[model samples]
Target: MQSDPHHDSANSVELPTPTAWPIITAFGLTLLFLGLVTTLFVSLAGFLLGLIGAIGWFGDVFPHPKHEPFPIRPHDEWPKDVCRVGRTVTHLHVGEHGHREQFPAAVHPYTAGFIGGLAGGAVMAVIACAWGYLVDQSLWYPVNLLAAAGLPELSTASTEVLKQFSLAGLVVALITHVTTSVLVGLLYTVLLPMLPAKREWIWGGILIPLMWTGLIWASLRFINPTLNARFEWLPFVISQIAFGMVCGFYVFRSTKVSTQQGWTVAARLGVEAQHPGEKKP
Candidate 1:
């Protein structure tokens, strides 16, 4: 004698009826786009399928949405282990020290990151320029390589052309270099704090640069064929290390501002006082 699943259930929920119209409509849309590269007949078939699906979907919802009643079994029918409730939640007061373990309790300000980035970028630029001068006897060579990723004209340029200075390449390189430097600097502020303070330099300056350098080496051909064809790995790795060290050190030295994790909503929003003795900002 098997008992009915919903025998003890008194309440039921009316959930939306499952239908195949949506699948048909999606298939039609896929075919419609596929037809652009195939034939008009495929497109016509897709349109017909889409129209029929849309009409059927609309019919299911227009006058009154179609729904199916789902009976919920009583709690007694549930497995004993699943039915057991966990311990009650305890709420912590805001700004209460040592209440919970919060990571990155503070962080360096954006201004610090910005300044660090500029400093790092300057150092990186100097190293890159020095590499170009030493290797190719042309200061413009490295800058041209950096810009070659974005500028189509430079992609196929000869080694002699790459050594020659171009105004367009200089502008592109400057923009790309500054933007990347600043973003990475800001990232350091967030990431370095999460690492062990005693060995942050090892992770940020050495390990991180090596890891990303390897990644870039692997993907450079796809990202920039022109640069990949003429990439000097040792110089690139050195520059990356210099940038990371400079940026990480600057950010680590900067004063850290407390996070808003311990602040109440009102305090965070500056709408009301956080504590009884505190004044609203």
Candidate 2:
């Protein structure tokens, strides 16, 4: 007979239910915002209340066990089970106690960033090829620029001089583009998680790309003067903006964790706690 791992009857431990710490913390934050216009003592009171509530809230959310708990590494470090889903693990088929279990923590940012970066790089490469074809009637034109920039013989050739497509150039351009795209994607993932969730599209997708475009434009002379001279300013600018937006979208979508899960998990634990011997509904 097959064992029902999902419904373990041997182990039964109830967990604490959600308390009012989060609500209290929200109110404290509201007071802190209003304190800027109100009296000094009001702000002080808000701060104190916020601090206490935050401590209580965290304790309530993840209560410390009387006995030492087993140390579980971040989700990224855990071994993959039957599911091919890299770090966004939903279940551990067989845990330390030899039973099915839910993943202890949420997905890591680095994992999300890596995936986002690859996606962004692919989109950027497609855009580059399309833009190059539109301008020069040949996809090899811009790629050749990247190759020519590295090779002095090709670099010295006049704009009028047309050389055969360079395999070396294609390779160089692809590597450079992918490396830069992945780095930018990783940066977006790191910053997005820490930042307040507001006006994300404008700040992440538009403003950041604009800033990167200007920086690249300014540094072109040092990076590759020949390529700088060869590059069409408008197409390059548009491509960079497109890359940023695509990368931001992927990063934003991948790294989100819902607070609702916390409540659900807590509620499940509460049920288990209330009826340790009975099967959970």
TM-scores of the candidates in the order shown:
0.61, 0.50
By summed lDDT, which 10 consecutive residues of candidate 2 come out lowest?
Answer: 272-281
Tell me the lDDT of model 2 at 227. 78
How many residue pairs in model 1 have overlapping backbones? 0
Please give, for residues 1-281, the per-residue lDDT of candidate 2 as tens digits: 02222332333323334478878888888888788898877788888889989998777646441222234456687687776655763453432322232332233356667777788778767777788777677777777776665677667766544235767667877787777778878888767555576867676777888888888788888777777887687777677777777877877777454222223344556753421222211
Clashing pairs in 2: 14-273
lDDT score of residue 260 within candidate 2: 23
TM for candidate 1 is 0.61
Best-fitting candidate, measured by lDDT?
1
Across residues 1-281, which tens digit of lDDT does each residue of candidate 1 receive? 02223333368656677999999998898888888889988988898899999999999888877776778778799677756577865644433442442444466887778888888888999999999999889999999999999998888899999999999999999999999999988888888777776788888788887898999899999888999998887889999999989987898888878665555568779897653322211
Write down the TM-score for model 2: 0.50
lDDT value for model 2: 0.66
lDDT of 2 at 263: 32
